[model samples]
Target: MNKVAIITGGGSGIGQATALRLAEEKVNIVVVDVNEKGGNETVELVKKLGVDSIFVKADVSKQEEVKNYVKKAVEKFKKVDYFFNNAGISGSGKFYLDTSLEEIDQIVGINLMGALYGARYVAECMLKSGGGSIVNTASSAGVIGQDSVVTYSATKHGIIGLTKSLVAEYAKDGLRVNAIAPGPTETPMVREFYAANPEMKENATGGIPQKRLGTPEEVAELVTFLLTSKAQYINGEVVRIDGGFTNTK
Candidate 1:
């Protein structure tokens, strides 16, 4: 059977990489993003890989938009077999006390609430279809206390909780939920964040055992495995692909 996947944040970085990786396996894709250009670009790329694909432009922080993306995926593909609840944003890297309410709201709105909305709506579709898998994007900050990312860390930690708790409620019903906690990944989001905080880039690299940031391709590989039957028994796990960044901490 041809698998179907809905990837939020699919316009770039890890979400884009995972969409392409899954497309290679002939999986139909629904690329969801607020950026129309990037989302359509991903759809074209997936088509070149010879798989059915479509783009749904959406701002995931809004519950209605999140539901619409899921609806569009089902309308296009008939069923959603995998969901990458990966849309998120990092704050201005200010100290928690120094951060503004607007920044806090934006971070929580996209990172935490967005993931929650995606999982709720997507899981409903999966349950109706009899089964499915979901992969959420967490961060090393989610697992361990990190400096200068208090709000981002809070949201990710919530992601880990969301993953395990969802499995606790739905695993027996053929639903699988897992999260990935990546560290200092080399993506546009991270690049922009690091560029704004030049000292952070050097500090992060110095702390990482690998001495370099991870690539989206690497995270995509891990996502592909967890979303497929190869990881049937790996439900509710938060696998960290942080190059030992969290290991030493």
Candidate 2:
């Protein structure tokens, strides 16, 4: 049978790229995102690749919404062979003290809590059906410290913790969990962030050893490998696709 994969934040950027990559492998896809337009667009694109696809609109931060998406995926696909727990947002670049409380809550709610909720429900379904693989989206800031994105960095750090801990508890049960740390990827979200904070963009590009941002397609490749049997032995690991950006730090 063809495999089924669920990708949260599947509307754009790394999520969309990963959806297309997996579709190329003939895997049926379930695209979940709050943006209905992008999610539906992805579903249509995946269908064009000659595989089944569906779109689930959801705000990952809400537990009920997360559950609904998982339910929808199971209802349509029967089993979730893979999950890309990749929904997140980069806050308005600001120093922690200068950042508003509302912003902090929103960041934590979506980035950290959303990821937690996804793993919770998806893993349960995967365990019941058999073994499955999951790849969480972490950031370069997650593995290391950075300025002006303290909240975003913290949530990413939590993601790493979630990845490792899940493996420790469930690897024996046939679930593999891992995280990817991308450095300043040129995704829509990153572009919007840099547009609002242009100086930070220049700084990010200059700091990276490659002197450039990473691409979503490149990150998607990593995620696909990790989520598939090609990386069956890899779990509880944080793979950094930062072009030596984190290495220099």
Candidate 3:
């Protein structure tokens, strides 16, 4: 079906890749991100793929901004068929106890609440138009315990919780809710993490059976799969794209 999709964080990383891939499939794209330059550039790229696209700049965590994003998207596209709550921020990268309350709020506010706000506004639209898919970006950190950036991991685990709960509540309405748990991916965010800690950089890739970092395109492929009929039976599940990082000793 030719559908309209709103992808948060479409300015870059896995979100940008997903927007491009979906547009290639003839899906109308609404690219939302705080980065004006990157978001508009993504819209340009999607338009080049012969699909309609728009860029809405919003802080995904704020209720008003997220509501405005959905409002504008519906005003433009009339309906939203897919919502990818992919915008996130890394907190003060520290041990959980050492992390301050402000940093904790930052992680919870952006990573967890951002996804929640997107789901809230977009789900209302999907319920009115027809049911649709919602994909939240979790991480390998969500699947397993992590020492560094512990608060970020906690928020990701909360994302998994939210995904499953929403799936159970909305499945009757034809809404499929799921999450993608990416491993060490080569996004700008991860690149910065790797750069800051050389030993961590080695450990993440070497610990994975694949012995390398995954790509944003790979995560995008998984997001597309879950959003499409191929994963119609898949709901309330977190698909791990960690290249055996969770399994390897």
Listed in order, each prediction's TM-score against the native is 0.99, 0.99, 0.96
Q: Write the per-residue lDDT of candidate 1 for residues 106-150, one digit (tens) a residue.
A: 999999999999999999999998989999999999999988999
Tens-digit lDDT track of model 3 for 1-249? 479999999999898999999987899999999999999999999999999999999988788999999999999988998888899876645667887998888778889898888888899889986699999999888988977878889889999999999978889999999998898888877787667776787877879998888998989898998998888889999999999998763
Candidate 2 whole-model C-alpha lDDT, 0 to 1? 0.96
Pairs of colliding residues, candidate 1 = none
lDDT of 2 by residue, 1-249 (tens): 899999999999999999999999999999999999999999999999999999999999999999999999999989999999999999999999999999999999999999999999999999997789999999999999999999999999999999999999999999999999999998999999999999999999999998889999999999999999999999999999998999988
1: Cα error in model 1, Å: 3.4
In angstroms, how far off is 76's CA in candidate 1?
Answer: 0.7
Top-lDDT structure, candidate number? 2
**Candidate 1, TM-score vs. the true structure?**
0.99
**Least well predicted 10-residue stretch by lDDT in candidate 1:** 69-78
- Local accuracy by lDDT, each model: 0.95, 0.96, 0.89
Q: State which candidate, 1 or 3, has the greater TM-score.
A: 1
For every candidate in turn, the CA RMSD to the true structure comes to 0.6, 0.5, 1.3
lDDT, candidate 1, equals 0.95
